[model samples]
Target: MKYVEKAPHVDPVRMRHITDEALLAELGVTSIAEARPWRRPDPAWDGPATIEEADALIGAEVDFLDKGRGRSRLYGFHYLRWMTPLVHAYRETGDARYAAEWDRLFRQWYGTRDQVEGDWPGLDVIWYSLGVWARSMHVTRAMAELADEPALSDECWAMMMKTVLGGARWSAEEHDEFRHGNWQFVCAAELLHVATLFPELPEAPRWAEIGRARVLEHLELDVRADGGHHERSPGYHGMVLDAVHRVLALDPSFAEHPRVRAMHSWFASLVTSGGWIPHLQDSGVVWPAGALRRGAELGVRPEPGSHLLDASGYAIFRAGHLHTVINYGPYVGHELEPHSHHAALDFVLSGWGVPLAWEAGGPPSYDDPGYYDWYQATRGHNTILVPGEEYTEDRKAGLDLFHAGQHVDVFAGHHHGYSARHDRRIVFVRDEPSYWLVTDSIDADAVWQVHGLAPWKPHGSGYVTKNLLVVPLEAPDEVLHGNGPARIPDPATGTAEYGEIHSLGLRRADGRFTVALVPFTDDPPAVHLATVPPLASPQETSVPDHLRVAIGGIVDTVSASTWARADVREGWAADG
Candidate 1:
């Protein structure tokens, strides 16, 4: 009924003739004759229009093999991820078209292969390790995830099992990115899934051992002590989480490990009141993956509240209506930079019922035109940008201090990207629960920006989004033409990669400004700024200046140096 060759490297002493009943029991089934009750197609998969997209794949007009959104460089569309939709659609409606299409694609791919080199010579023609990894998952899903077994020619099914064993052997030794990227999590998922699906193979036991060991090592090496993924992208963080969840859900061995639980907690910490994770690093404004929702059912998250992760420099504040996540620190991995941005003190803000500000140029086709010029540039973020600072490796930021509170909170960060110092402090006041006092102190001229959910229009005295008003206390006469372009997200079907958010900018000569962000609807709110210029101290050049800012009738005296109400000053960025 099935076929597999013993790989050469598998230890013969470790081999065990596992019975058919035990393998079926691993999937919670009594016999191989009965259908597997627990083998899901894709765990943590979340596409807004999954059925519609899957159904479209059955149409002749839509080619499931169209690589890349436009760049033709992506290998994901080739043989990988195409099976998920067909299998998903088939399960949803018992559609014969979905099955028929899978048969068509499978034969087409199988026909292209003539021989094997290190298990996959013709399979990975375009690339080496990446092709092997992708094909391994694809073949595994075709044979394993679809337990109902798409009706295929007997020859095709047997050929698939042979490939499965070959893939296990080849992948057991290959170029691994465990220390640098998300590939390790993906590899671990694939290896474990292989072991669980086909333990009768001689290599299955060793595959399980290798997969578990990698997972354990990943918990220590790839995930930071603060629980954030070393790559620094929350979207990727969720991806790695989903990989771990799906494979372990099949086995149930390491679900309760302390590190695993902590990983779940870290992802949950970024969830906004609106149920979406704020864009961070290369991620976009996105909803949590199905796996994250599944993890919540397992009850692994820590206590709820506003708090700070000092190691990763993420100060997450979540309230009933207001949500914000700010990140800054030494670069996570600069050797082989993970998908990241040059954003420091840049944050995503959502209040009332709409998104205020968000990250820009979400994971684009890596070769997209604006991939470096705009998406990864410092000016692309909602932070101060010096003119000469392009999206280089040196563009960096680090948190100076963080203070969390129920009614008020504070965050201060600094970056010297263009050989000039820029310090930013944000004070969150919850009296009204939808306001912020942001002060930026820079030693050089800079272009301050805001990546708004909507394109910025000339709204009276300052910029305004759908429901948020950005009122700069120290106003610039006009916004410079150098900034303000729309950032497009990757067109992957399952991912909600934010939208075409616009980057708005204003040039400042002295690079010193205090801004008030207030969320309101209907009538516009009144805002006032009274600058108390330092009593012209010729003797003391570093005298602290103070000011009064009034937003929608609420007023407070903010100090330029301390970045908070004069009476409320306890810590400053300079304290270190």
Candidate 2:
């Protein structure tokens, strides 16, 4: 816990040399100080307004800042994103009054330091507080140009250093109960970067070195070879990489690490066609600015047409011609993490300056049921779901493994609402240029039913109006439900299509049943396939397809079945 005292001040020459080398290598350029062209010129704001405009935004933020009541005050991290624009605007306008207001807000939140006590309030605030502080550094030079407040600058630096290093102490926990795995590392990395900036400050050198080592270690274990963060949320993955990139840029020692560069490439690969990241595993709304900046800095580009988004939506790897946004995976890293929700295999796609197919936004507050419930439900994501249940219980909200050339994850345990039954597996594979997802479930007891839909619709319009499919299972005593008409039976296949189904529906065709639901719309409708099993699987099973499938195995009697097939169409029809 001891920090280095009386550490030597970093030499300006050394700092510049190291910064130049890192930036040069990162951008793949011969020089470090060159300014890259802005992706878009700053939009013209109307005639400059006084502190009133700034106050209006702040007041609006305050109105929304109740414990998860509105968007602004859900968590400290959320606050940081909101605060960034304020800090930047205030710095740009050279408004001392606005700056004074910012200082007042900061003090109001953290002044007594009493609120910074537990995991929910204190640690959460600190985590985002570090981000706000880090972003403030970018505008610090701007602020310096407008004002002669050396005292304010020095005070900000000292306070940030203390807060960052202090947060690192809580990161030692290995459970989700205390910290998110990715956020923990983010805090650590940012702390190290802050420390490196002011080496002469107390404990700066020692804390920096320790934090750096810890972050690298975690990166090696958590970041997969395919560039997907192990935790499986593209949004959170981007955030973690952003923090890492900051530290790497600040310190030259990380410049040569392959993992650091690989992480960047991994993020670029996951972007969707709409300029949004794939909502894999607990992902939520996120801006593409950080990812775009990271891509530009790292010289990593997405392969042409390899992403779901168009060129503008995708981050160009090699050239500085296009703006790029990277997705940080969801959830902070922690062992047996609890913040882990049922959001397995989620992504946020963006285009231009807007997000396409964004994960539903959440406030940082934990008080609202919408925030907590959505965070824990599979309904909020673009994934497969079993009929009549949520996610599994045991492994439902924990990271499986994210290393080597493969990335594997499971959403078992409690989140599924089944304390006794277990039969579900969601797997995502990235072999470059192609992404494969497989959902397999087994039902031996036959006590449950399985179904599927194309686009995920939580509301009524998406179901009745959108192009979706509903396949029903008809056991002797079981009933089937389709969206539109009551139960229009398919005369040819003996299966019912109550609504306008774009694809084929599988009903009690033969003794065994299988259905393929394809959406005629842009993206496929979110589907859920469930089965009633008499017994649990003795082993795991694999189903290959872009669509979602789920199986409801009988309590403790179900097991998964594995089959190898070259094509998705063949695999779906092949007998096990």
Instruction: Note the Cα lDDT for every prediction shown.
Output: 0.62, 0.38
Give per-residue lDDT, candidate 1, residue 173: 61
lDDT of 1 at 171: 58
Give lDDT tens digits, candidate 2, residues 398-480.
22222112221112211223432223232222211111222323342222222223223332111211333323222222333
Q: Per-candidate RMSD vs. true structure? A: 6.3, 13.7
TM-score of 1: 0.82
Backbone N/Cα/C clashes per model: 1, 100
Of the candidates shown, which would achieve the greatest lDDT relative to the real structure?
1
- lDDT for 403 (candidate 1): 69
Error of 2 at 78 (Å): 9.8
User: Can you give the TM-score per candidate against the true fold?
Assistant: 0.82, 0.54
lDDT of 1 by residue, 1-576 (tens): 011344233222111122355433322323233323224656544443367767676644434334334432444444356556876676678766776777666666555543312222243432333455566665655554344544544345434545565666655664233545676666676777777766655667888887777777787887777777777777777777777777667767677666677777787787665566666776665566554666677776664777876666788777777878776755555332357777777877876535677656455555567767677767667888777656345556777767666556777777766577778888777556257777777777777777776666666577776667777765774585333334322224423533566666777777776777777766457666666664465223222367666765566665533445434543344423
